[model samples]
Target: MELYFLGTNAGVPSLQRNVTSIALRLLEERRSLWLFDCGEGTQHQILKSPLKLSKLEKVFITHMHGDHVFGLPGLLSSRGAQGVTAPLAIYGPPGIKSFIETSLTISQSRVPYTMDIIEHTGGVIFEDKYFRVEAAGLDHRADSYGYRVVEKDLPGSLDPKRLEAYGLKPGPQYGKLKRGESVELGDGSWIHPADVLLAPKKGRVVTILGDTRPCPGVEVLAKDADVLVHEATFMEDLAELAHEYYHSTAKQAAEAAVRGGVKSLFLTHFSSRYKDVEHLQPLLQEAKEVFEHTRLAEDFGLYPVQRST
Candidate 1:
């Protein structure tokens, strides 16, 4: 899995950065893309990347802020125009359904595919065979949220050497054994999967938070996550201003990452005032002081979330 940062600015767009939108590409796992936040000009940013609109399977909105949702309707309409027939699911806080429906109605937009808009209060919102998503209410001016995406543990692979010991070669029987099934040999003897399978591998965890101040919900959603994408909207010196605006400073975000025990933290949703890399270095440095593995997110940056051994 990989995270594609479509926009990384806070509140509004700037010459260097756009607003907040992130695309989680699950191409290897599921051949789909799951978006977190669709800030204004998000579709425009996607066009600049290698992402395909047709692969967009789900969208998770963090809040109702215009910077986070203004591009959603336009993107949906464009997806319809592109003739993508696959169904899409959207999860967000209450009033999200109304927001999408109202925008589509006012614009007279027609989406050809099935769209499932789920306005969840909190907790587990989605779960399939491969992944599970849980939401936690966050501290913000609006009813914001953070999402924890937990990938299901994968089954162990069949050992080729062990199969060879049983006089088996690569074939459909190996496929069945790999699936944890028992296979009958030509001699009428049965071979169990455990006899040839290796240890199961652990899945990865990714936590993405919307605009918020340092809160318990952040800790809950980010605990032990392989990747924690948190909004660092201000520098350490602006802690008071950040608190007042229901936003987090880089230092605060890194502290939260430490508290959550996340493997790595990616700081995003930067204030537009930091126009250049030189201006933004302090934010990253401050975060690094608290969490050594903290990284500053940039527009169009692709971060790979590798599986845990």
Candidate 2:
């Protein structure tokens, strides 16, 4: 799994930062991509990356804020111009349908692929055989939400040596054994799959919080997550302003990550007040006081998992 930051600014776009969009690339046996929060100038961010518009299988909007969703219409229209024929599904807070409809209607944009709009009330919004998505209503100026994206538990690894020890040669019958069924060999001995398979590997969880203040939604949604993408809209010195604006500070974001039991914390949605993001490190270090593995995000940077060395 890979997380590519399209934009890392909050409230407004900066010369160095676009609004807010992150691409979750599942580049493995099953190739798919998921996006969180398409902020302003997000389309321009996509242009700079090696991402395909057609591969955008799902988009989860954190809120209806202008900076969070103003780029949707343009991206949707460009999806067709770029020849994306795959169906797209969008999940967001109330009024998302109207927002998309009005944008398309006013601009007279036509997309060849189907667009599924689901205005959620905060719960398990989507699920499939391979993945599950849940949402939580967040404390924001408007109706906002956060999403937890979890991939399905992987199948158990098959032990070929055990099969060979059982005098079973590789063939179509081995396929049956892999499915946890008894396969009859020429000697009439039954082979059990469980005897030669390892336990299933746990799936990774990635939680992305929309613009909001410190709340329980993030703790609940991001419980034991492998990666958490939370918004840190301000520095610790601006705590009062962050709360007043329904945004979070670097300190608060880290605390939430600790409470959520997240393995790694990625802080984004930085305020444009400071030209250098490095200035926020001292504030983020405050969060490390609560959670050790915290990182301040940068635009166009990719954060991939670093497994055991």
Candidate 3:
């Protein structure tokens, strides 16, 4: 799994950054892509990357902010134009469904695919064989939310050498063992999966939060996450302003990452005032002081989510 930051600026687009949109690429795992937000010019950003709109399977909108959702209609229309007919699923807070429906209707854009809009409150919103997505309310000017994506634990691999030592050749028995089932041999002896299989690999957790101040929902969604993508829309000097606007400072984001016990933190949604890397360096330094494993998210940056050992 990987996260592709299409736009990382807050509020409005700047020459250095666009807005807030992230693509969670699950190509290797599921051969599809999940978009976190679709800010204005997000489609243009995708054009500059290696991503394809046809692979977009799901979209999770964090809030109704213009920067977070202005490009949804255009993206959907473009997907149809590209001959993609796969069903799409969208999950967001209340009013998201109405917003999407209204935009599409008013624009007279007809997407040649079924779209499922799920206006979730808080709690587990989606669950399938491979992953589960949970949502929690966040403290923002609008009714924003955060998502906790939990991947299911994968089954351990079978020990070929160990099975060979048992006088068993690779066959259907290996499949059973891999599935944690015991297999009986011709000699009436049984071999348990634990005897021939390695330990099951733990799944990863990724927390993606919308614009917000430090809140209880942040802790709930970020707890023990392998990667926490939090909004850092202000610097420490503007902590009071950040709180007033229901936005987080870089320092606050890193502190939250520490409190949530996340393995790594990616600070995004930067304020436009930080025009260039020179200005942005201080934000990264502030976050690093609080959490050593913090990274500043940049536009078009692709971050791989490595499997936990």
* Runs off by more than 4 Å, candidate 1: none
How do these models rank on TM-score, best leading?
1, 3, 2
Per-residue C-alpha lDDT of model 2 across residues 1-309, encoded as one tens digit per residue? 889999988888888788899888877725878889898788889999998887888899989999889999999999999889999999998888999999999999988899999999799999888788999988999998999988777657777788778877778877786676777667876767777777776787888889889888878888988888888888788899999999998889888888887899998888888556666677678778878999878888988854221
Give the Cα lDDT of each candidate: 0.94, 0.85, 0.94
Residue pairs whose backbone atoms clash in candidate 2: none
* Tens-digit per-residue lDDT, 1-309, candidate 1: 999999999999999999999999999999999999999999999999999999999999999999999999999999999999899999999999999999999999999999999999899999999999999999999999999999999889888889889999888998898888899988889999899998988999999999999889999999999999999999988889999999999999999989999999999999988997789999999999999999888899999998877
- For every model shown, what is its TM-score relative to the native structure? 0.98, 0.95, 0.96
Task: Candidate 3: list runs displaced more than 4 Å.
Answer: 180-182
Worst 10 residues of 2 by lDDT: 300-309
Q: Candidate 3 residues 172-266, lDDT tens each?
A: 98888887789999999999999988878899999999999999999999999999999999999999999999999999999999999999999
In candidate 1, how many Å is residue 119 off? Answer: 0.3
Candidate 3: worst-modelled 10 consecutive residues by lDDT: 155-164
lDDT ranking from best candidate downward: 3, 1, 2
Tell me model 2's lDDT, rounded to 2 decimals: 0.85
Candidate 3 TM-score, C-alpha based = 0.96
Best by the TM-score measure: 1
